[model samples]
Target chain A: MRKSMRITMILLMFLLFLLFLLFLSGCGDKIDLEEAAVPLAAGIDLDENNKLRFYVSNPVFGDKSNDVQQYNIPVTSLRESRSLQDAYTSGALEGRNYQVYVVGRKLLQHEDWFKILDVIFRDARNTVLDRMVAFDGPVEEMFAVKPKEQPPLPAILRGMVDSKSKRGTTVLTTLQDMHRQIYEEGLTPVLSEVDYDSKQKSFRLLGTALLTHKGKYAASLGYQESVLLNLLKKKATKGVNLSFAIPGEPNADVFELDRASFGIRKIKTKIVSSYSDNRFRFRVQMKVSAALTEQLFKYDIQKHADILEAQLTQQMQDQLEKLIRKFQRNRIDPVGFGIYARAYQYQHFKPLEEEWGEVFSHAEVDFDVHVKIISMGTIR
Target chain B: MNQLEKHSLSFLQFVFIIAGIQISIAVLSTPREVSLIAGTDGWITIIIGWLITSIPSFVVFKIMQRSSEGTILDLLRKKLGRWIAILFTLIMAVYLGAMAYIGLLRTLLIIRVWLLQNTSPFVVLLLLFIPTYIVAREGPKLLGRYAEVIFYFLFWLPLVYLLPMKQGRWLNLIPIAKEGWGPILSAVPGVLFAYTGFSVAFFLYPHLTNKQYAGVGILLANTITMATNLLIAIVCFMYFSPNEMVEINQPVITVLKTIQFKFVERIEVIFISLYIGIYSLVWIPCLYYMAYCLNWVRNGSGERKYLIGLLILIGIGTYIFIPTFNQSDWLEHHLTNFGIVVEYILPIAIWICLVINERMRQEGQPG
Candidate 1:
């Protein structure tokens, strides 16, 4: 009787398993690649009416007529905008393939706007590693720039930031990094900037956009200052090239030869933090071990190498000081000097944590550069 | 079944059982809870938590050593009264049942979020019980072997976390003990819960082939658990800033999101799916031991019957009420409190009572 009971139990379980597979397969909900509106880029900007606009560009699979579809709607919330996207697309918007999240300067100039991104971090589906690009004008203009002889705009934007960042020309920021930076009191945030020239119908990758703790745009850094910021932050290490005009020389031709250029092979930066008289001080000394990549109108290299080094050191020190003065004037700490002060002098930094940017603008800051020309490249 | 030999479990299997059970759903969020209190110095609290937990673990090992041929229930029935023994059985059965439920529910919740968004949690809970019943019916011999096999299968999980270490900043970990020892010590009670499964040693004692090495086995188990928690805590701490760490629900898997291979994307999804394999390590043993506890309550009468009955109860319970994520978290919190009473406080109280009672009885006998 027990053996028969066990046999009956096994059969019952088997029947239940079959019943489950037949009824609850969940296979009917499967979405094919073509049926899904897989967005390549997601953009946020302030529309002409000063309303927050959400945009997504999805590529059409196996059809070139509507090669890519661009849709924009004035949004009140970020994630809710995904549900309203079915108005234009054949299928629902899929966020899994987003390669870039383009931020318009108009939206970034407002205060407390970073909180709109709460859905991005809260939802598990949104990609965090997508590169974050700051567009100078409306992000719609950026999406409108469909350059010929190129890949898609999203790929171009992503590759543009990646290539410039690798060359130490701009900073590489991601959605996750920005999320980290806002909460990280030790450092302010920065993002890679891009501008479009309608006359040329091309988008240009510029330098970094400095942001305050409230996610408001503070100031902008050009390529040279961006390289200095990268060196101070020690993020970009490979292919950092710097150019300088020889001191006291004006351009004598339409093509000027007064400037010299060199690629940075090895760079080192040291910062010392001290507190005195109710203020903090940082002595930032940068040591550059460089190889000359290009030199325009240099008479002799092997002879006056020390003179060149000394001259470059003086010029570079002036430039580095100028960058620190810019940071002070803008009341930003992208170099994260606050981290050093907090780490070494905790008691003093803890009290001023709320307004470190304001206090930093009034603190004592200094910079010095040391140049060592390790090689003159193959030409010399 | 009759062909099975005495002393069926090896010493290493004994250690893996404790290690596997101790590193359950709690290890995934240990860093987050610890970071909320202790900041980046949380890894140091893990060390101190080890020192605190290993003490009680050793005491439980001592209690188990007194009765090598039987479990804590047998020891209590002999030394303490039958009523007290029954009381321990009922309390512990409830605790272990709650743990098994939470482990099963959490696995389903993760699956519902990451892998199969549309599948019902009750059906998946039913599916998990198949293996739970299969291995559990054979007793601890198969459970120990099952844990050992799963251990070797998912052994590379910790190594997978190291891939994202390159993008992590080391500055996040510095300025240790920034708030002094108060917060670090307060985080210990939280880690004490992650260390709760070591109390399972009471039932695991009789199954060991070489019972003399049980003490060393448990010490090794606590060290293994501590080392695993330390590695995960430090990795999560370094990868996310403390402010970000506190906000994430499961920073452990979230850290693996940044790792992209040429063939795969969102590796965290694959890891979360594979994590269900580890869930068996938790529930299978808890199910069997819970049955063992109730069998003791019936004076060693009907174990398999109680096992089947308990599994059915859980099956019906989940069907009637499919738990959301927050509900499972509530269950986990209550389980930790009950586990503290059953696993931590009761053993020490039992050890004291057994010591005093033995002294009086030995003095009267003059042995």
Candidate 2:
């Protein structure tokens, strides 16, 4: 009797396992990739009526027409917007292949606009590594313009930001990166910026947008300035080509070369912060190993390399000092000077955590730049 | 079944059983809870909590050494009356049952959120019990083997956490102890919840083959628990900024979302699914002890019958009342508080009583 009971129990368990698998196969939201609307990119902006405008671009494959289908809706939350888009699309909308999330300047201006993104960070299904791009105008306008030669807006936008970041012209920001920066007390957030050029009827890669922890837009950096920001933030190392006119010479203007260009072979930045006399002082020293990539004027390479290096060093020092003053004037630390202070001088920085921006503006800063032209090209 | 000593556990088995029981569902949320209180100073708090929990564990080991009884129930039956022994056994059976139930519920909750969103919790709970019953019914010796095998199988989990460190910021841990020692000390009680499974030493000591090394084994178990919690907390602390850490429900698991391979996406889903193996370590032992407690109440009779009965009871109990996430959290909150009394306080009290009684009885015998 006991042996038969044991046998019956084993059979019952085995049968139950089979039934569980079948039930699971039939239960829940069963979706096939072929019928699903996989969004490649999402654009969010504030419409003219002050409503939230969400744009989703889904790339169609194997059909050859309607190559990229777009959806536009005005919703209050990301979750609602996604569900509403799913209704209009042919199949359920999914973001597993999502590559980009763009926000417009008007929406970023609102201090609480980041509150709408709670669903993105909270949902386990959403991707956190997707590129986060901030645009100068309506995101819809950028999404409306299809890529002329590239596959679609998602790949084109991603490539634009990535290439610029490689050359140190912009900072590549992702959802996780922004989340960290916004939450960290010692650092502020910055996103790669793009602008829609109506005349050119194309999208251009703007430099970067500096934002507060609350996601409010504070200031912007141009392409040349973003290189300096990236270097100081330690986000980029090589491939930054610096082009500036020689000081005191309006334009040597040799041939068609506009300015001298130096391709950075190596670069290093060191920051030392100390507290003294009821104030904080910071010293920023930069060392650069550069190759003379392009020269506007005919100069002797062997005889004038030292003179060129000295001149570039002085010019870079002045530029860096001016940039520091600009950040001070704006009362922002996009270069993460506050992080250095808090890291190296915690005793003095712990009390002033909330007022770090104001304290940073009042602090004294010094700059030193050293440049060595390691290679002057094959010609010179 | 022929000779009880044949079912005894080696020192290594004893250590893994303690380590396995200590490292279940609690490790997932420990980073979040510690971060909420102590911020980045959580790693330090984990070590301190480890040292504090070792105190009760040491006392329990001492009690086991002083008594040569086959189990704590036998010790209690000799010192106290049979009724008192049975009463304590019932209490322990209820406590272990509740703990196993909570662990099983939390595992199903995580699976639902991450992997099987559409599967009913009842079905998932039942499915979890199959492997659990298979391993647990063989007694502690086989349970020890299962723990050993699972340990080797899942040893790579901690290394997987290092993948997310590429994007982590070391600066998040700076200004250490910024809130002073007040927060770290206060968070110690919270950290002790993660170390509660060490109480299993009280029951496992009689089954130890080499009792001389049991002390070292339990200490090693505590050290493993400490290291696991410390590694997990520090990883989450460095991966997410202080403010973001607070916002996340389980930074340890959520941080895994960023790790993607060329062929696979959503690795956390795969991890949460495979984590069923580790989660079983909790319920299997707890269920085994609950069954043991029931058999002790019957003076060590009908062990298998009692094990099957308690398993069915747990299944029916879970099915009748499935806890929502909030309710499950509420249960864990109460369990942590109740567990401290049972896991730490009750053992120490029993140790003190045993010591005094032994001293008084010795004095009378000498006279």
Candidate 3:
């Protein structure tokens, strides 16, 4: 009986220790739910008063009785502070900081907006990397314009941005992808610009906003050019349609590129150096796959497979060359030419850093594209 | 020998204990330091160091096999004089004791960082040591058996990390041997530390039913451990650049944190919990070694109560002395280097002296 009592006492002690450990496990105090607001998206714009205007979207829980409601707050001068640090010193409104934000689409042309991005990344409380977009006009107008029928504005925007057709070219830019482009020497940050239509009360994707090497506004690629950019970057998904022309046809032939199975087997870049004038010549060799979508010529094109292949290869090669020339003319090294040069010719690239723009502009480019038309769809 | 009473562990269990000891906190962080010294050729040094240690590990097992019923303490005393044997035994005891203490502290620190942030250090240490002491007091056979059970937990941890394998870059291990052989040669000391726990087999040698299989068991253990460590090191290098790894104190735990499961919120928390079993696998053996050494010191007639008291005191003393997480880190770094010397060099030196003593005895000469 005494021994059993000792055993019971020891067991009780062990139980107490376990309970104590459980008690000490949770660290911080519970946050008041009512005081906190979960911001799905936010927008920052410089209003006419020349003060920073912050617009936040607070998501409201939907029940059977209540339709989904979103609260929008347009606060001019987010706290009466002058400096950026002082501006946020008043603490987040309702214990929520800006989770996602949009800058005025015009601000993408200013190049100085990247400095604002650096500040956002440095903040600790902001955890959500939901979505970010650049608006064509004031960011406030874009946030104020709501969709007519949707589960929620955030969900609708998320669906549009996450859609494969829009993701790479016309959707929100992820922080990780943006950071990667910003740090890479030749690669430029391609952000999606949004324009608000007051009549439709909706947001329209205005294609890709390109940030220059110096973090300035370089140029914007329209919808067609943005799709071409996505294909070039290999970010294009399956079911993407690419239209090219047959040799003598006025109308273009469309092909649905199955990017999932597509392979860039090799990209051989050669830089032929001319020591006399310090001029560099570039030669690029690309291997890609093309799936035929439409047969422009009605005649038995199956027998003329080689002819069709040649025409398609020549057309793709011409288009790629034109795109490369456009990039060079804009003084933008979108192909990571500088990275390639550093990897191959370190000595030449060291002195060419200051004159990279001029060198890139004057460098002659030769394209050797090997487009293997694997299967001409089910038809032919 | 009755079939039912035959005291032997399966080959897998033996491998688990061996690999468990080898893949400690050292395997997680030592690769970065090794990289600093060996540059891109650190993995090569690790392979070479494993080979260097494998030779001694085999020889130690061979020596144990030659003695049917005696432990290393008995063989050492027979080969050398009593005083020298006792001296070596004391050194090994101290080394093993320090290893257990540091392992416990580091395990707690990892738990504190990854799981229990609010728990006091004393509470963490107490919770960890209580279970460790209970297992230690149970003796070597139970420790080995416990290791067999916990090995499954240890096995699944790497798979948790494999979730993020798509992000790993094979190019990170590229430009191999670009920094030359100078750093590779310098990294040998740290590389050998990962293989230190194979020496624990010496203390548990007499407990094995088939002593001759000891060498094979240890060799298999060493090979498995070296392979696991190599994979971990390569994966860590591929996941993060050398500069990024250098900034992290607990690279392995941090690497686990980077892994996100679709259903699970934080994989590191699961890793830290599973890692408790791994720590027990190492701690039990070390504590058993200390207790075994204490038994030898008492001429194998020590009271059970006295030994338990000594074990508790040692646990408490080490816990108190090595206060704070930083000191524990320092203790681990310095003791690992110290362990290589005492656990490796001292044993080989004593073995040489033992062989000489046997030769002299066979010649009928008393020096």
Candidate 4:
């Protein structure tokens, strides 16, 4: 009886193990992605008739080679759909299943753009966030301008974003970040806009696209302006090029200012209020170590570093003032002045939200740039 | 008609089970709320709460050391009379059983929403309870030994979950003590709940090889739990704004899902599977405690059959009652609040009464 009981127990254990293995195998079969194609990048646009146009990419094996190739398929709808499901069904009829549908540039003008985003997020199949992008034109145009000899559109975009050599403005914003920005107070959503040339079959980043809270197309910041915005937000690299002309020089000399290496001794922002006219004045004091890129003057630049410091200080001050005025004109609060007001002086920001455009326009901003050339790139 | 064999658990096993109980389904949802109350200083609150809860744990451990051969139920009966002791034990047993059932249910709901959407909750619960009931039926020693082996896997999961910290904003932790002491004080009770399972050591004292080391073991376990909670809370705080955290249904799991791995697409699926080990760790002790309480109440004879029958009834009732996520949430909140009172306040009260009784016994004696 004891021997039989042991044998029965052994058989029972074996049966349980087999059942466990079968359960695992069943789970494995349910999770098959073989039929489903994973999309790398998605683009959306509105056609001439204001119909929803969806662009999707899927990689396929190249002929006579082990290398993979990407193909862009465009699908267009006859009428503007209120829901993504409608748009998706229309696209599906065109023989393309969009795993991710980007909100086209024209949709930025529509009031229900956030509703589109909600539809995308609600779907489980469209799980990838990094591949989603918002375009300035028809989404199909972006797909038409692939790199001449690149692995794929996704690889190209990923390389551009991850490139270490590209100083400043290299960080890529995912769809998740954009979603957060939309909900966050005092922050505007920024997306990379890809403009394509059909004749040349080439695509280039048309700088960052900015959106207003009501899904209005505010404006696109040019490449240089976007770089400046990134720097102000501290999202850009520390080692960015700063160009300024000498007092009598014919040519403008460019200096690579390594902000990381530059010893910033102090940064003080004083908010001074004048009893007269009820105006707030922002005075910024910045102290930094100077580094020279080029020596235009024959005189010992180090000896008369004080003169160089004065010139550089004035240039930096003027540049910063121009950028600040530009930001105010554009009604962009990338410097997070609004965030500061809300977090610190909540009462002040309560009314400022309604009158932000006018308030920001008249706000006094003073810059005090003090530069001391602590070192000259470890060379005399 | 067999009595439960006296079985002892190793220190490591005790730590694993206690840690599992401490890190519950609430940790997935409550970190953000706690952070909102305490701001960047929320980690400080976890530490403070751990210290406060440790005091009771220390007192219970001391009492258990004195009565080395008896469980907390025994000490309660000896010190505070049988009726009150039985009443308190009943309350604790119910609370623990509810908590275990609710935890299993909540986890099933998460799995359904995130992973196995097609699978029924009953099937999921059955799958969970089979392993849990088998191990729990083996008595506390085997449960503890199994916990010791599984604890290694649990410890390694957090390291993988926290890899996305590189992108976390350190600035989000700024403006420390911004809300001041008022909110911090209010959030202490919730933080105290995170350290609730340290009291489990009291019940498991008889099963400990060295009852004296139980205090040290509990303190060490509490410290580790406190640190883990603090880290997760801080990370959640840094990742999401106060408004966003509150809006999220399951903040911890959602945060884990946000972390995209190059090789592994969704880490939350892994988290859900590994969490079963934690659930079993918590449920076994709770079931054992329930059995222990029932045995004591029935005068310790023919209790094994009764214990198994009661477990099945409780499990089935809980499964039926908590049919949806909303209902489970309501049950969990009320039970956890009740748990704080029974687990912390009542234990301290029993300890005080026991101390007084010992003093009276000594004073009443002639020198």
Where does model 2 exceed 4 Å of error? A1-5, A8-14, A17-26, A95-97, A197-202, A248-260, A263-266, A277-279, A295-307, A344-352, A373-379, B67-69, B79-84
Error of 2 at B233 (Å): 0.9
Tens-digit lDDT track for model 4 on A87-116?
432222221223234557776777546545
lDDT of 3 by residue, A1-380 (tens): 99869956885797688667667664443445654445566666676665556566655544542232333333434332223322332323342243345766545555555555553433222332435666678776666655556545566565556663354456356553454456544355666766766777776667776667655556677665666566665456544555564555443346433121222222332333322356556666655566666664453556876776676667767877887777777777655565445434546765675446556777777777766666676663
Where does model 3 exceed 4 Å of error? A1-12, A24-57, A62-148, A165-200, A204-240, A245-248, A251-285, A295-300, A319-367, A375-380, B1-8, B37-41, B241-261, B299-328, B365-367
What are the per-model C-alpha RMSD values against the true structure? 2.5, 2.8, 6.3, 5.8
What ranking emerges by TM-score with the best candidate at the front?
1, 2, 4, 3
- Tens digits of lDDT, candidate 2, A69-148: 88789998888887789888988887555788899999998886777878777767667778899999887778788766
**Which candidate would rank higher by DockQ, 2 or 3?**
2
Model 1 Cα lDDT, one tens digit per residue, B147-253: 89988999888878778787776767777888898999988777777777887788888878888888889889889888888988888887887677887888988
Task: Rate residue B179 of model 4 by lDDT.
Answer: 62
For B1-367, candidate 3 gives per-residue lDDT tens digits of: 2321343555566666777787764666666767767754577887888899887887787667656566788877776668877887788888877777677767766666656666665566656655665666656556677787777646766666565555454544544664556777778887887888888777667666666677888888888778777777776665554434564456666566545444754456667787777776666677678767867876876424544665568557755764676777677678878978876776687667767777888888654
Model 2 achieves a DockQ score of: 0.49
DockQ metric, candidate 3: 0.17
User: Residue by residue across B1-367, what tens digits does model 4's lDDT show?
Assistant: 0222357777777777777787763566558657657755676687778888788878767778777466777777877788888897788777776766666677777777777776555556556655665676667777787777777767776666466576565555544555666777778887777777777776777777665678888888888788778778777766665545665666676667667756776566778777766666666677667776777787876445655675578558755764677787677667768878876887778778788988998998965
TM-score of chain A of each: 0.93, 0.91, 0.73, 0.71
lDDT of 3 at B363: 87
- Of candidate 2 chain A, the 10-residue stretch with the lowest lDDT total is A249-258
lDDT of 1 by residue, A100-174 (tens): 999999999897888998887777755688899899988888776656766787888999999899887889988
Sort the predicted structures by DockQ, highest score first: 2, 1, 4, 3
Model 1 TM: 0.94
